[model samples]
Target: MSSGPRDDDVLRWYVGVPIGTNPLILMDFATVLVLVWAFAITAVVLLQLFFGHSLTGEHIQAAARLATRLVLLAAAGFAIISFLLLRNRYTALYRLDREGLYCENMRMGWGEGGLGELSKSFHWRPFAVPPLRDPAKSVTKKVPWRLVDKVLPLEGTRTLLFKSGRGTAARVYCPDDGTFERALRFARAHIPEDARSGPEKELQQS
Candidate 1:
């Protein structure tokens, strides 16, 4: 049986994901904002150039102004909804030693001022029609080495899955090469033999 990290030498890994990593999120905010604002500005300018010299077009001018405001408002509303739907990923911290394993999910949030701190203040639209669960984010967890039932290495996804005897589990997604190898190594060294899921064994061979 292989032993885990020493008490005096715990192994640690950290992962931070940026909002711009996914192009879908970027497109959601960027495309809508650009298209809506551009259309509204263009419409207003065209109306002024075409009818500004007219003396009896007060009603037409008022209607154009109102339409521009409505378009801008609709665009802003959609952008806000997209922001709430596509919340950012949380930071992940993993610690493993001879005794146990610990995984923490740190969310990014506005600090007291504008420092952008991490906190539990991650409040999205709870009643969203599509229900945004933010699968990339994880909740905090701690488990003893013995209580761990299995460790599965997801290759294509570059993630590690830790299942516990108490039915609790944690999934760590690797954003880069460093985190993926470190997590796989930690799971192999610490997890018990009987708890090796099929994929985990393949990871060991490779």
Candidate 2:
């Protein structure tokens, strides 16, 4: 029986994830403030323009003002539901080693585009619907390494994606943060000496 390390076995560890940051928690406040401020500023400017003209058309002015406020509110509301909350479910970490690629989904998030796939509903209504389902973007579904080749990390989110090396491909997405970090540390610890980089190389030199 082969006793040493096989060319395709990987070691993984589960590291704990830090609590969600305060800034992340406070994003709701930030969004509300920005929206309120933007609307207020626009209202002030429009008021100045309308009044300066000495045209006392209250009905027209009220309609235009209501339209502006409704538009702004809709934009801000969609931003919160679609991005702030849903996108958080899309982060993950990826580790590549000689024993094949290892992908761990351990991040927090919900909707697509953030770390998930933009949904069919979101296709026509980008701002109205959360990213729901897409076969190509489903790269974080945990699977054995023998099936993956390329892995893409979502920008600004913790989601990591995996795919067939080339040609026809399958995809996976990982959104778990704590477990993925731990697995990455473990993979780094066991990666072959020849394939190690950064501090890994330095450690071997010592």
Candidate 3:
């Protein structure tokens, strides 16, 4: 029902997440690439077995060669696509207040030189790469304190995961240790006592 938080009502900051910097982001891309490669190889093998007379050593060898080629080609394409989509470091605007948390991914522009520049060239205009989201628009999510059922901290990534009954409500990425501590303290004070996870003493020690 609420439109969004007013600027004066919250603490706001911008965080830049560059490609290959966050393991969580990298893992997501890797998972997708693996799935694509597996599906392609599976489909090919299924088709070969369906139409072939019998499973022979030669058929297996041929399938192996095809699979290898497919994996290499898929990997290359995945890397290219990932670079094109993420070349511009992702910028997220985070706003926190007594009420809840708000996160918005600002529009991004391609950087100069390399693939970014190549994609913008007139010669490649027809096949130009597009951003994952509309480059001119931002995407936002708002999570209220009342709706938050759990607060999970990931020390490795310096990220906080807020979860509701449905699933993950929102994710907050901290830029540094100090910021992470501040955010965690805020979360502890606002979220329900029962919803807190992990050792409180360990957090205090850190």
**lDDT, ranked from best to worst:** 3, 1, 2
Q: lDDT of all predictions, in order shown?
A: 0.55, 0.41, 0.62
| Per-residue alpha-carbon lDDT of candidate 1 for residues 1-206, written as tens digits (9 for 90 to 100) | 11122233476655443343334335565676667666765666566668774434664466557666766787566545434433433455667777777877654344331114323224221111111123344477787877777776666555666777655466655555555676668767777777777876677768
Residue 180 shift from truth in candidate 2, angstroms: 3.2
Residue pairs in clash, model 3: none
Q: What is the lDDT of residue 181 in candidate 3?
A: 65
Could you tell me the lDDT of residue 127 within candidate 3?
Answer: 17
**Could you tell me the TM-score of candidate 1?**
0.45
In model 1, the runs with Cα more than 4 Å from the true position are: 1-9, 17-82, 111-139, 165-168, 197-206
TM-score per model over all chains: 0.45, 0.26, 0.65
Candidate 2 error regions (>4 Å): 1-29, 32-36, 39-43, 46-72, 75-174, 183-206
> What is the model-wide C-alpha lDDT for candidate 2?
0.41
* Model 3 CA deviation exceeding 4 Å by range: 1-9, 57-78, 81-88, 110-135, 164-167, 198-206
Give the alpha carbon lDDT tens digit for every residue of 1-206 in model 3.
Answer: 12222334355565554444356666776777677667766776777788874677776667667766776786676556545565534556677898899888764665442335533322210111222333445788889998887777887676888888868888887666556667777776777666555675346446
Q: 1-206 in candidate 2: lDDT tens per residue?
A: 21112223443322211122323333555576567656765565577678776434674566467656765686677556645554323332334454544444343333334334433212210011222323223334334445543344343334333434443232222234443343334344454444444664564455
Rate residue 176 of model 3 by lDDT. 61
